[model samples]
Target: MPELPEAETMARDLNQRVAGFTISQVLLAFEKIVASDLKNFEKTLVGHQITKVARLGKWIKFELDSGGALLAHLKMTGQFIMGDWPGHLSGQWPAHTRAAFLLTDGNSQQTLFYRDIRKFGRLRAFPQDELLSFLSQLGLGPDPLELKPEEFHQLVSIKKARLKQVLLDQSLVAGLGNIYVDESLFAAGLSPYRLATTLTADEASLLLSHIKRVLNESIAHRGSTVENYRGLEGPGSFQDQHLVYGKHGQNCPKCGQALAKARVGGRGTTYCPICQK
Candidate 1:
């Protein structure tokens, strides 16, 4: 799954390329990807100019001048590819390509392709009030990259679940995934199995600082490309330096101990026994 940083990067990129362009065509190859009836969805978007592009959690919001937003959630294998006009690429869906948005500048057209192999990506047209109601359920704690150390400390000190699970929960801290959870724990010398509420206040403070450090570092490197998590334009190279997330049975970077792997919350977790408690 693309975490916060990746989604934020994609939103920023699309904001630059697609905002201010009018939707000349809204094509849906997979019906459920859109919110309303197919005809209604098309009717709502086809003539509206994109006023802005923003992100809420992992969802992409394309605010239109015509009074509704086109929101998309690129679940697991989804991608948004920008196709240049006059040389528009031709290819079949290939068990992917949930939807496509073609925008025009009256002189040129740009095709924003949304491809999701898992078929879980979603596109919705929502009124502002309805959208706000939907967002309210997410309990978005805060952007890890933007949280102050003191605020992060206060939030984590109150949780009682395992440290790893607490970090992964979107309600507690909005953008972290399995990869960053492991990396952050390893950085802070806390075991993935450490009980969240069992930590001392000092430990909690350290954990908070370490979480931001790890996440900000990951974003600076364009996030880890563990699976197919590519940057907006293409795949990134950050996977090359991951300290523990995917380095099972390999030597830990800091202490040279073997990195271990196990199942936590049903996801693969990797860490260093000596370095991470």
Candidate 2:
């Protein structure tokens, strides 16, 4: 699962590698992958020069010179990689590539492929006005990296759900998934089961600090690649730095007690019961 760090990595890599490239052709191996109208999807993308690439919460945004954009969400197992154009036959596509964009930088050309093993991802094309409208309607909370301490504390003070569940709510605070939430809570010495409304202002600030730290560190390492997550460059190495995520029943790094495993908001969570308590 590619969260903020992974999305950040992809956006950064794309800005560096593919920015300014013009979309010359659009090919769709699986039309359902597009969440927008089929009539305008390819027509709006092709012939547009990519002005920039960015991430809004967990989604990737591809900005064009014409003020239009292509937005992609790599839902579960989706990712982007460089590839060659496939043959006319559908079977000739590279493994898991549902869509491809042939790009040209005047002198050179390349192919950008969207791959998803589970086919759960979605892509959409929008004009300038429509893109702004869509983003406004998405209703995501502040990006954790840009969130102020007071803002985090205030948000936590209003929420009534468990700490982990509130953190997982994109509407409350965007970009936190199971891995970073557990890691942040453990690092802050807070239990995932703790109610968000019960946290003191100082504790909420402390948790915010830990959340930013974990996310920044993961972004630096290019995000965790515990599963199928891969940036434009390659798989991330941050999984090597994980403390509690996916490490159930293992010895806690902070305490000798065995790490406990449970479900918070139906997401598999891992933490040190002794330390977190």
Candidate 3:
């Protein structure tokens, strides 16, 4: 899964390649992948110039010069590729391509393809006023990197669930998934099963600090590529630097104790019991 870091990297890559280009045409190879009405979707995007690209939590946002926006959520296996649109009916297009945007920059043309092997991603278009309402409906929480320690602690402490479950709640703190949650807990020496309300203020501060550090480090490495999480550029190297995630039976890097694995919040979780407790 491509989390915050992966989405951020994709946004940056897209900004560099297509930000100033105008959309010459829209292709919906898999119309169902679009969340908006097909007629409005294509019509709104056809002649708009992309002014900027940004990431909100784990979603990619394309800011248009026409005072509108295009948003995409790559739920599990979605990705974007840049190249020519394959010849019509030539079967040169890669499998699972859901949509394509043919772009122009006065002197050159390029096609941006949205591919999702599992077909779980969705795209939507919104005018400026409606875009604000759309984002409000999503109710995504503040980005973890920008949250103050006191605010983060209050958010988590208000939840009665286990630490891992609270961390995975996007409404409480956005952009954390299985891998980073486990890794952050390990870094902060906290148990995944620990009750959120039981953490001391100092512990909360430590956890927040570790979360920010881990996210920054992962972003530097281009995010973890444990599954279908390759950015527009390529797979990330952060998977190689993981501490407890996906290392269930391996010796704990810090404690040399056997790492333990269990199901928490219906997701596989790995942690070093000796080191984290």
Candidate 4:
């Protein structure tokens, strides 16, 4: 899954390239990818100008001048790319193009394609009221980048679960996934297997600092392209900067001890067995 950085990169890139364009039409190759009602989805987007694009957790939010929003979650293999308007025929769409937004700015037109090879991503168009209601019902946590150090420490202190589980829980702190959690924990010299309540206030603050640093750095690099993740610009190079997220049994970069791998809440986790304590 593309985490905070990937989503942020997509938002920034799209905002620069596609903001102010009106949705003249919409095309869907895989109708199941629409999370909202089909008729309403097209009705809400067409003719509305996109004012901005932003990241809401692991999802992308495209704000409309008319107060509606087009939201998308790039689940496993989903990504957005630029393309030309195609015929209504599905055969005319690019490979893996699940959805396309036909955008116009009076003078010219463009197409923003949502391609998902795994067909696991989702796209939704919502009126202002519906968007608020859906987000509240979805129960997304506070943005990780916006939280103060004390706020983050207090939030984690009450989890009482494994550090890995606490960090990965979207309802507690949004925008964190397996890759960044492992990397942040390794940077903080903390073990994922440790209980969340075991950390001191200072330790928790340190963890948050590292988490913010890693996420910002990853965004600067456009996010890790370990799988099918890319921005309108291109694939990210942060994967090359990874310390231990995918190293598994490889030797730890810090202490030369083999990195340990295990499952936490059913997600694969890796850490330095000796350095992280």
lDDT of each: 0.77, 0.91, 0.91, 0.91
TM, every model:
0.89, 0.96, 0.96, 0.97
Quote the RMSD, in angstroms, for model 2: 1.4
Per-residue lDDT over 126-213 for candidate 1, one digit per residue giving the tens place of the 0 to 100 score? 6666657767865677777777766776777688777788888888788888877887798889988887777776777787787777
> What's the true lDDT of residue 151 in model 2?
90
**Residue 224 error, candidate 4, Å:** 0.6
Output the worst ten-in-a-row residue range by lDDT, candidate 1.
85-94
- Give me the runs in candidate 3 sitting further than 4 Å from their true place: 86-92
Which runs in model 2 stand beyond 4 Å of their true positions?
86-91
Per-residue lDDT over 89-207 for candidate 3, one digit per residue giving the tens place of the 0 to 100 score: 45455688988899998999999999999999999998788788989999999999999999999999988999999999989998998888999999999999999999888999999
User: Cα lDDT of model 4 overall?
Assistant: 0.91
Candidate 1 global TM-score: 0.89
Summarize candidate 2's per-residue lDDT along 1-277 as a digit string, tens digits: 7899999999999988889999998889999999988889998899999999998889899999989899999999999997566573455788888999999999988899999999999999998888888888898899999988889999877888999899999998888888899999999999999998899988988999999999999999999998788888889999999999999999999888899999988999998889995
